[model samples]
Target chain A: MISRRNWIRYSGAGVAASFIPTSHASQGRVVVIGGGFAGASVARELRRLNNALSVSLIEANAIYTACPLSNMVVGGHRKISQQQFSYAALSADGVNVIHQPAVDVDPERHLVTLRDGNTLNYEKLILAPGIDLDWQALQGYDKTAAELLPHAWKAGPQTTLLRDQLRSMREGGLVVMSVPKSPYRCPPGPYERASLIAGYLKQNNPRAKVLILDSKDSFSKKPLFLSAWQSLYGDIIEWQGESDGATVTAVNAENRTVSTDFETVQADVANIIPPQKAGKIAHLAGVTDRSGWCPIEPVTFSSTLQPDVHVIGDAAIANAMPKSAFAANAQAKLCAVQVTRLLNGESPVHGKLINTCYSLVAPDYGISVAGVYQPGEKIWTEIDGAGGVSPADASRETRAVEAAYAQRWFDNLTTQVFA
Target chain B: MIRTINRRNWLAGAGTLATLTVQPRLLAAVSEPVQSVLKRDFPTAEIQPGRVNIELPALAENGNSVRMKISVDSPMTPTDYVSFIQIIAQANPLPDVARFDLSHANGLAEVETRIRVSAEQDIVVVAGLSDGSLWSGSAHIVVTVAACLDALY
Candidate 1:
């Protein structure tokens, strides 16, 4: 059922059909690197869409912990166990699930080298490795400091670490969270984290304070988040936008202090979410740009730096779409579809993409932003009025419903990926 | 347990301290059992795994967006139609993903939607018959890569 329209167009008398790539022949090896939202979705969709294609998913960890709703974990609304998942389902479905770190990729030879000193060849390679924290952005914040001042931007041990620090601090102590510049994973995540932490401190330590030291002038869903902070948390939380000269210049993780141009502030606990770049694997594969992110063709997700290599998820520069799980999943399915057609010698057909992200300001309060995106002349663009954040003036009941919807969305999205 | 916080000054100047492991008691404070909402709601209802169908992919690449279609084999007549339906992801942070209220007007007991899963888990669907009996169906999804669990280091 694979289309061969491109073959006919490229050559007369159907002679191009013989030259069709048997190396990437149907039922050939399709290796997917990184088992995050983007990689996993592409691998599964590839297999489901074409059973003949042998799909192998390479992941480093045996178990996965989700970042979405991890704020709730910090707020004590949920536990980390609730977010953990295994690879049993994907393995049962015939996708070869390999738990190993892929060390390098030789695009020229179509070979992938693993940390175990082994190699695997593939006809097509899909890289969905997520983002990496850029330590250079903040002085004195490195791997060692991350242990003391956890970013918790990734959902794992760091999350628990941050939660524990908040729990152990003095009831009336100050908790400072620093936000970096844009083009990072989960644009609205830091604000959501701030709100949830405030919600936690509000209940347990009513006298406690939360300070948001931001590097950016503004943030995703700024108006809605700020409005919620004012009406819900009030004096307990203080946000210093970039306009206030809140750009953090240095950090003393051990002392829980962050220094901005204006002043150095000490805190009981500090969470410094660092600037990010494409995960290390993307750079190793030589698919990244000067921006430290992989650039890809909008329709195919094919890396501009390498042939037959596609990048998705937080690592790729998807113009209109924020680096989010939902966006990554959407991009993955499109990549799978296009990659399949390309394997079958057909021209790729682009389609509409959608992303919706929900952030909880309180246990029963929520807000969301959604958009339908399509390819533009140069990059991706959101359809007008198709995507926007939840209204600032939404009622309490409406917010509660949105909260329920957010949980439901999380469940549904997770089931779509893992169950 | 309290030492980590008070040692900030000492630790800051030292640059690094290897002894600051998180206290197990702290993680235990938030740890709880994964309890299913359906079992709580229908305590007396014996959910038999039959007469219901859950259509989903056997393998999910990304647990963020899995397509699922659930249906019950029902007569759909006023006397024999299904009353309500619930889809649950047993391992999700929130197990009660979605619930549907159906009536005889639907003419059929069916639903289709996309779901997110954090890991490899069961997608369970329970349908309440008009007689108050609950029939269920479930599909096992293998997720090579998880969704929601972000910040892949």
Candidate 2:
């Protein structure tokens, strides 16, 4: 499962000072690929625990915009800048934040090749490449179609494009959104987007309608959303599951039409969330299984297919955990601790892992689901009675408070990952 | 320390095991318990968790405004439909967060809203169907700040 990279000599100035710590003088180097929540947290946590251990974080992007709250940006409730974060703070903490995409990993030689032809040697490597959409799976929906339809799943240009399209759309027009099946990132995300879009349409174009055609028979938080749709905006939102002919078979982006087996839907704006797979780097490193996600050792998050390498975040097949930002951060913290232990010649022990995800139905309304998990015979198992969705039938004031908490949670999470 | 090779093959079949199935099933196969309210309300019904999905954060930064959504798998036909849906917080002072009365006219068995949580607790949802059966789903959340007990007044 190792892919060797061509060696390139690095300047001594950056390499010399990184090797000087006394306590971890023997741990060698730890290189983390991808600077998203999982990779960044592992790199920073490793340095925090043992300064002597050489750690390097390689990232393709200079700034990170979170996918958690990107829906709000598309809904115009938030600006993209508000969700954007910098790695300068992590750099200030003595992490060598290399802004380069890792091209290859050499497990036998313990070296990583960067796009700039530079190579980094490591005792261990952590990979967190997030997700890549399976564009081919969605007929007529590719990277080019994404530019027009705009899934807005990732937080950059696609988000802004969706917002712009919604703004310019005529009143009483249609908005068609197609959701992929399970195992995609943010299971409840598509529903939240529909709710927010419905809210926006209600305010600007009272006659407009939102149509959500889902591949699955149901989605997370079904009752709460149904109730909100009934009470918040009646007749403005229509959702169809597989039973109701909502499983999208193909999408005609040129005509802004999405076709299910039985019905063809036309929209002024269509958002087709395609099927997903592990990012390219995961496949390049040969850590992914048939599921298009990496399998890892539960205790250390090290790759099951590859040794001396760990897979975290959305790319890993964490069956017990969803591919959420919070889960990634939690896994990163655990991976950091376990990787450090491995370097120090200690065995990693089991621990409870936590994940909490919030979805905004509107600016003043929010909902969440949470769980506590521990290692099971197969994978991490949810602790009974430890987590569930937010209570239904909450008062307006409660919704407002939850909405406020959603904002705070976003802030808290970004700080933990980047700052 | 679980071994890697064997576990990987086993887990590959798991495919994110936390996912709740949507199709209705026999009650005895369900591992999670039916809320007492549902058990008492539909005495003859077999309550299960599948076909009912609750969307909410696993963690709450504050307890005040936890956004949530609930959806059930149903054809929404007259012969088989969801009659009502109820939301309950296991640890709240008044556990009945809200109850929604639905019918075949609703076209979909789903709802989205926000709720105030007093503390870290599990949220329970139960749906009564036309066939005199009950379906339920629950999710646990950790709330760092209390929303119900805040001294805003």
Candidate 3:
């Protein structure tokens, strides 16, 4: 006669006794900031784990445009609608989903202030505020300049803006993309974007050339990407790594010119991805370290500076885990479990974590890197003899299979987190 | 052991298990090739499936470089130790990935490495014990493409 939900709860009790809420345990309130993959997943997971606890999710946008597949939109392979999701499902799942920008947070008082001047109280605050572009990091690059030269890193209007610029440029024109240094979100994203853009130009404007000015000496999946570039796009795509004097210091939006350490190149379209840091809310809460990212206890994801507040996703400095959506989702679930255990007056336990990053060289060509990590004494460490990149001499069929699986992964992840 | 059980149960309850629907064709496509390779390589050894453990991701972001760890539950003494382990990717063009030879001096019956997976298929690990018995284990992995292009800026 038990309902499905109760049946699951009862059946799981024998194995996860610590997770089951006791009658004496008081109902607590948890407030989450930034409803991206990390925030949304934690909110829903908390609700699923214990319905008695009150959960509220604060997100700036009503519709989230995912960043994982946005490059395809820029390359004209997919529509922006496919990359967007609504929060109705999370709300229906008993989370108090608020469509408001959280402007500030007071860690001592455990309060979050929204843009419209209202404050929400919580016993525990979870911050999944992702990252923000550091406009001042690069000279001549600011909010206003972004309109002319779009970064398109956030995946909404900027994604379409960059797409429009690429579509309208004259045939045989130059497309310049500037990449920031390491510790940025998605280590292999820029290379994948460059590859997809070149794929587009190869079919539409056969004579056009795409130039990548990278700040790092090397990148993820380099050998696999380089081989694909050679066999597929050949002369259409060019990459200049850090040693090639490709560190961008400034950009003249009016002239469509990007200046590196040694030279200034004028282009028909300029895509500048600047250095980044934790979202503003994390800084206002005083949880972020001097590195511009939040430092947390590796086991519980609790902020080192503010133990009552936890940070996940790209905003937190998760040792050895790259800032990708997959990593964010994985961290969110682990963090949720710890938060639940802490609320129930139990100590947090370590969990196994894994991250797999996939990048598309062409629509049918794909590559990836996988790593299994564990919480170490002070930081997270990659398990020795586990995780690696794809082999260099794989056949064409392998690439095609990986490409299809990439789409499937996107669909599955978005559905699980935000559907 | 309790913590590991909790993690597995939570993972199942978290909706990840719902996305894992094995395609029958994928299994059918690899069974013959895998059996043929096993018979051709281990001509005299009889393979069983109990002691070996193959650890791998259920859904791989990239097939090109998937990491795998293999261990067999055997005491590493001169009288009773694991001798060698062979890895095979059922659907790969070149199915034989690697083979690691071991001895009592090695102290453990475990090996870890990164490998290339050509498709969504089973990765089989077979261990040869000094007692002339072979133990086998396999993990079904779904190797997908990368999703880095959509990173939040």
Best by DockQ: 2
Please report, as a value between 0 and 1, the fraction of native contacts recovered by candidate 3. Answer: 0.00
- Candidate 1 vs candidate 2, lDDT winner: 1
Model 1 over residues B29-143: C-alpha lDDT tens digits? 2112212364366655556657877767544334555557888999899999999988877666677788899989999899876677665555567788999887766666544
* Model 3 error, position B140 (Å): 46
Span of 10 residues, lowest total lDDT, candidate 2 chain B: B2-11
Off by over 4 Å in 3: A1-26, B1-153
Query: How big a share of the true inter-chain contacts is recovered in candidate 2?
Result: 0.00
TM-scores of all models? 0.69, 0.71, 0.70
Per-residue error at B27 for model 3, in Å? 69
Instruction: Write down the DockQ of candidate 2.
Output: 0.02
After superposition, the stretches of candidate 1 with alpha carbons farther than 4 Å from their true spots are: A1-27, B1-153
Per-prediction DockQ comes to 0.01, 0.02, 0.01
Residue A11's C-alpha lDDT in candidate 3? 22
Candidate 3 lDDT, tens digit per residue, B1-153? 001001121112211221111233322323555656766777556666668887775544345555578989988999999999999876777778999999999898889777877555667777889998887777766443333222211
Residue-wise lDDT of candidate 2 within A189-302, one digit each (tens)? 898899888888899988989999987555677778888888888998999875676778798878888998788878899988998888988898889875577878777888
How accurate locally, in lDDT, is each candidate? 0.77, 0.75, 0.79
